[model samples]
Target: MFSPFERMVAGRYLRARKAEGFVSVIAGFSFAGIMLGVATLIIVMSVMNGFRQELVTRILGLNGHINVYSLSAPLEDYSIMKLQIGDVPGVTSVSGIIESQALMTINGYSTGVMVRGMTRDDLMKKPVLSDHFIEGEPADFVGYSAAIGRLMSEKLNLKIGSTFTLVSPKAKVTPFGGMPSSRTFTVAMIFDVGMYEYDSNFIFVPLDAAQAFYQMGKAVSSLEIVTKNPQHLNTVKRDISLITDGVAGVYDWRDNNSSFLNALQVERNVMFLILTMIILVAAFNVISSMIMLVKDKGRDIAIMRTMGATRRSMMKIFILTGASIGVVGTFVGTALGIAFALNIESIRQFLQGLTGTELFSEEIYFLSKLPAVIDWNEVIAVIAMAFTLSILATLYPAWRAARLDPVEALRYE
Candidate 1:
């Protein structure tokens, strides 16, 4: 019913001519709080998504979509295996890979590195390696040649034409004992992939050069398989397993970096959950303001009750008030959040320039700058949570409004 009492209360609250300045301040703070919380959550989740995407791209690009290896000994007749595996569905290219761990030294600086050997012809087919040349050339291996990562080169003070010694543990026996020993090589080129781990630890060489250095004759360490569709890596792995008679182990990129990827996902989820609570707290400010409004309009509510207004109607009115605040706050927050997520890179750069400090310092973060990839799903989840919390916050205030006794409410007036 459109009673004067109901109209008077709603009009007074909406017009704000008689509203307390403190209530207005509380409402303003509540709106700002929600905006900041939503914006932060979106930006943070998007950045995490960005890192995850980057890691997958760089790791899978450099490494193959899938790898096939033998647990017993190095693979024999790898060329035969390559042809057979290539015939399988989803298989694009299968290349022989010889890899060994070794220590490299240049200008008296030493670092541990993974030496991966590939044929020049096969290397041309691999987009990952082909795309990252920063100095000199790719692997020639004619007379002890190799392409090292940019970070490793910098760490060891290496450059193009710099003769670095790659000392690998050799299998030479001595009169004293049959203990493994070491050997050396030279640096030919430098490549940068923008991934700290790979850039600092991988060195590319010719397959024969690696085999000879590691004393592995007629044996290949692993088979790197590139699929036509990277999304079907598991299917390719299964096909390879069937063809290889299960003698070899097939591993996909997901298996290789499971722990790190899982940790990143968990971290992102936890951060969003924690930050969403800030919005929930801010929504409570709406509850407090609504409850105070009900108290201030007690006489008006009593008059409405006398005019046969139902308690449910009174409840709906206050609930609408609380919900309106939430609607306004959620709308503002969602807009701000999307904006921040999309422009995160620019914001990071501006902050870095303003402070004269890097957001991601190489010495600390392993990255020169922050990387962000906005995940729309995460943004939507944050918005949903804020809206739910805002609506939930109104319940207590609405209940109080519904429970008011008309006689007691109007006795003082």
Candidate 2:
């Protein structure tokens, strides 16, 4: 606790007179550095957090949490498999998917895409496909119709009720050779999952139609499953393994996309370390400025000591003076960071409009919009780290001021 006299002296020292202009400039620079460092760290971390969360949501929303595939052959009697998987303790829903790589063409425009076949009921189980409809509604997903992505629809110049030909390599082969199979399917639904790749490269069709087109009979490529808690899928996976009895292979989303997720985590950690250095540099600036302030005010420290000020009081005064910069800068920086992060997308768009260029490209980032999610815990951690550094930075300089000898300081002056 600072005494009234100590607080007054600290406050007086912080206020710059005309003769102390250079010291004030140094203090100002240190304040700006701390402010910018904290703000940059918060904004970048928020964006990274938001980016990872949004990707996970869209990926798992469309793909489910776990995948089951036949180890020896394609999954036959998939309906029974679905029912058994659904009955598992943590299991929520199981959808049989007949996936095949095929080229789709219309009016001389063609692109290769994955065709995922699902029954209407099974399609409804996946919220991403069932919920997102930019053009047609869920009721139209019946019969031989297909659900396409928004980007695909745009690229091929398609619309509701527009027909496209899907050509598959798998077909019945006679004595002549092999003939590629092709079928015309009307676009019943167009959806946007917000991810650039998934939106542009997937087509969904009725299970019966897909089976007929692929000559798959009643077999499915795999079983896509959702669970109550994806994070604890090991137990569910083991249970599913027992239920399937070695007929299938089971894996979770983490297993399927481990490398990509690990990459994101690594990048997040690296960015945090790199940004923390900025704050560290600002702390160094605080130390340098405080030391200089102590040296410049040596005679003042001597005079105050002669006026009955204790050494402890001198230390407290200097500490308070230096810490004021850190505390105030951190508070202002925190407010600025949160405000900027919350409006980052709008700001990005505004900049893009002003520059006449796309700022957040869906093709490069796989997301159409910039995201910023401020984790309160992370923000608290940042504040604690900065506050601690600021307090520590003032210690040595404050100690130096407290140790000043009145005779030595006055004799030199």
Candidate 3:
């Protein structure tokens, strides 16, 4: 608690008159620096949090929480394995899947693609695969029918009922030499997963069609498993691996996308440290302004000390002045940061239009829009650090003021 005398003195020092204009200017700069620093840090961290959340919801939703694979061969009896895995305590759904690389040619346009093979039941189990149908229905993919991503369809100029040729590198040996296996498939549907990578490079075919074309007999590449709580994937994956006797390789979604996600985390941490320097710089500014204020008010400090004001009172007054700046700056910065984060997409769109450019290009990032989510814990931490730094900045200058001898100070006057 500040005494009336300390509060009055602190307020007077903070509102420096025209005679001490230089100190006022320095204090203003310190306030602005802290405000900008806190706001920028919050906005950046919120965006990173949003990115991670989007990946978990959209990307991991399309893929599996955990993937079970054979150590050396395909899972021949995937149905039995699927049942066993589904019976696990936390498992929600298990689907047999086949993933392979191939080339597709349509209207003289050929592009390499990753082919996904799944049954109608398996397709229906994952909403990410089944929900975004732009053409035909999942139930209609019965024969040599396939589904293509919207981006792929647009690139190759394909439509429903259009026919395309699939070429697999698994060649069939003949009397003359080995010839690549080729087949024609009718396009049954088109889907948009929103993610540019998936939309541009993935296609879905009937499990039987994939088996016949790939020359796979009663075998699937892996089992994709979803859990009731994706957050518990590590424990569930370990349990599944143990139950399966380690004959299969169990991998979680984070493991599959470790490099990409790790890059995000690393960038987030580095940005936090870098942005924190801004606040540190502002705190140094507080020290500079406080020192100047003490020097200019040396006569007042001497008179106050002679009038029975303790050293502790002088320290408290200066600390209050410095911390008031930080407190006000922190609050203003938080409000600005939250407002900006909540409307970041709109801001990004406006900037993009103004500059005639794409702020978040789908080609480079997984998300097509700017994402942000405020974390209150991070905000609180930033405020605490700023306030502490501001109080610390006043220590040396406050001590110097308290130690000034009245006789010496008045002699100079």
**Which candidate leads the pack in lDDT?**
2
State the lDDT of candidate 1 residue by residue for 1-413, as single tens digits. Answer: 44565555554664454347766677677777877888777777877888878777777787878888897989977787789999989877888898888887766777778888888877667666677787776544455788887888777777777787777766656898765545456677677777777778888888888877887887899999888887667677777889777678888888988898898889987987798788878887877777777777788778878998899878777766666677677788788777877787788889988999867765455454467787777667777888888778888887888899999997877
Badly placed stretches (over 4 Å) of model 2 are none
Question: Arrange candidates by TM-score, highest first: which order?
Answer: 2, 3, 1
lDDT, candidate 2, 149-240, per-residue tens: 89999988899999999999786687887888899999999988888988999999999999988988888889999999877888899889
Worst window of 10 by summed lDDT in candidate 1: 10-19
Colliding pairs, model 3: none
TM-score versus the correct structure, for each prediction = 0.88, 0.97, 0.94
Please give the TM-score that candidate 2 achieves against the real structure.
0.97
How many clashing pairs per prediction, in order?
Answer: 2, 0, 0
Write model 3 residue lDDT over 125-201, tens digit each, in one string. 77887788878877679888998888888888889998999999789889989999999999998998778888888
- Deviation in angstroms for 265 in model 2? 0.4
Arranged by lDDT with the best first, the candidates are 2, 3, 1
Query: Model 2 residue 348 lDDT?
Result: 98
